[model samples]
Target: MTALRKTTTALISDAAPFAIRAERASDVAAREALLDACFGDNRHTRSCQRLRDGRAPAEGLALSAVRQGRVVGTVRLWHVSAGGIPALMLGPLAVEASSRQLGVGAALMDHALAAAKARGHRAVILLGDAPYYARFGFSAAKTGELSLPGAFERDRLLGRELCEGALDGAWGMIAPTGAPLPKTKASRARKALLVPRAA
Candidate 1:
């Protein structure tokens, strides 16, 4: 299993798991740094990035696992059309190496799924190891007919239906259906500066 898919080891009885919470805007930098450390610099070029490019995650679905007030883990889900069925795409679940054995990854998965369900999302799709995600009910059984925007391992594309039968008959290419991420004020102002002045 990859670092992101690590099995929980026997945790110290007094050592509480990292606390999970909705990610704050302040976590933006730390989260990116953690993701880079976990997935390296080239992480943005992957197939899942295509799904997330220029989009916002599903409302309230981005979570962070914090320890000692430091963000140690992160997970986010984005809205997508799972082969024509409405679904969320989960990705880039990352935990700091120092916290791997504390069950941070599993906690993030559970919390993210719960939040997604509470928000009325029907299903979630992700590319990850089957053995690791299996405990959470993710499988390829319902995603056999779905595909990503770019190269991806066929077996790694997995889905879990939050609503039973959510994925029934879902097929074809999965595509992003989330709202576009809002442009930063600096970027928007830069664009305005570039506009031609009235004659």
Candidate 2:
């Protein structure tokens, strides 16, 4: 496997001076704060956020770049059905402005995609600059018929198939497919009581 598709621990030692790793719960605030600094408050109103809303990222796919123990970059992939095909929606990739020149963003992309492939994910789609993501194998050629819930530029809808042909027939709406959170015991009990008892 290529270095970018190897594992989460793989480091971009030459281009990036920081370490890339799986994101932890403790990194949430720092990550969110970093994203805000990079993308600003308007980020939540973007088209990609529709798929990420109220959904958890694919297990083991959220990643962060750290330097001196502080989060400087973040990227996450969410479980979604590209039309009818299983795929992951990559989004909200952001790196601190101060760290941009250090290649933290690219390194985070590599680490996250690698972890996704290792986890057996078949495809990944994103709404981003075609020119930038093209280097990572994303293209809009196959995503013409696919769309997001909110408005987005057509040419910006890009996808990359982890396995050959994974997205060949993928067409339609991109909707969240992440597992729903389990009901709490109290909620289950309440639901059970609400069911009418047979006479």
Candidate 3:
């Protein structure tokens, strides 16, 4: 058996500096900055972001890699519909530039996927480099007929069925299907402030 089991992973090696763990509320700012530095400001305009807008990530699937108490990597999987089939969307996996050499990205992927499967998720879809994701069992073979909300390189769309044949007959558009986030108090106040009072 490997050091990583099913639910979560925290790789500890004498040479490794970071540990993989479930993303915490306090990691938000650092994770966002790491994403921007890795993906640039236009990251939100990407096709996958459409599948995540106004939606919350699947429970217990978001992960972060921290080194010396600093968030050095991040990954999150959101719920989406693969045609009519329920699935999760894995994406925007980013590691701090300098920490990329520490294998943080791959560790984050492994931990997140294991957690998703442990939670009984059937399958996962992602738009990423087929070469890199292939090592994790993601492939374009089952996603050829699926479309994203915006333009994407066809070859980059991929899926991995956690359960045998989970993605069978999966086709058509991949749309956001995650639970909607409730309005936060700050958001409610901002919206109310934008409204003009009735005269």
Candidate 4:
């Protein structure tokens, strides 16, 4: 098992309480920095990134664990089809190293999953330690036949069905299923000025 996998399975017992909320525009830089600190730049090259590339997170599914106004942890669920079954992909759950033993990572996972369920999502998939994610109900039992667009460890692919039997027959390649994120006003304004002129 990898060092990360070991760390994930450590299971901190005293997780300090933190406020969970929807991610905001201003949180982007901090969130990216946090992810880099935890997962490094290599995170973008992972197989799961293929599903998230150019796609906005599932509506209202990106979240942050904040402490005293600082973004201490983060987690997001992206829209994906688990073998044609509409589901969310949870990933890159990270916390400040100093905050690891305090339970921030676990809190973030719980918050993200609950939020996904509240949004009516039926299932969630991820590639991580089976021993760690199993605590939250994710497992390889239902994901044995599912595959990612890029190469990945078959054993690391895990999933959990929020609604019973959501993954009963789910099998095939996982594909992006989300609508493009809405353009911000600033982006729209820039595009409006770049409109082509007719001769």
Q: After aligning candidate 4 to the native by TM-score, how far in Å is the CA of 99 from where it should be?
A: 0.8
State residue 1's C-alpha deviation in candidate 2, in Å. 35
lDDT of each: 0.88, 0.83, 0.86, 0.84
lDDT of model 3, residue 27: 83
Superposed Cα RMSD, model 4: 11.0
Query: Candidate 1 on 1-199: residue-level lDDT in tens?
Result: 5643343332432457568999997887788779878998688899999998778889999999998799999999999998779999999899999999999999999999999999999999999999999999999999999999889999999999999999999889999999987788336533543565444
Residue-wise C-alpha lDDT for candidate 4, range 1-199, written one tens digit per residue: 6987767645431244567789887787678778777886587788998897667888888889887688988888999999889999998788888777778788788888888888899999999999999999999989999999989999999999999999998899999988765668446533543565344
Error of 4 at 123 (Å): 0.6
Which run of 10 residues does model 3 get worst, by summed lDDT? Answer: 3-12
lDDT of model 3, residue 87: 95
User: CA shift at 35, candidate 2, in angstroms?
Assistant: 1.4
Q: For each predicted model, how many residue pairs clash, with residues at least 3 apart or on different chains?
A: 0, 0, 0, 1
Cα lDDT tens digits for candidate 2, 14-132: 44578888888688768767776777768778888778765778888888899868898889999999999999999889888888898888888888888889999999999899999
Model 1 global lDDT (CA atoms, 0 to 1)? 0.88
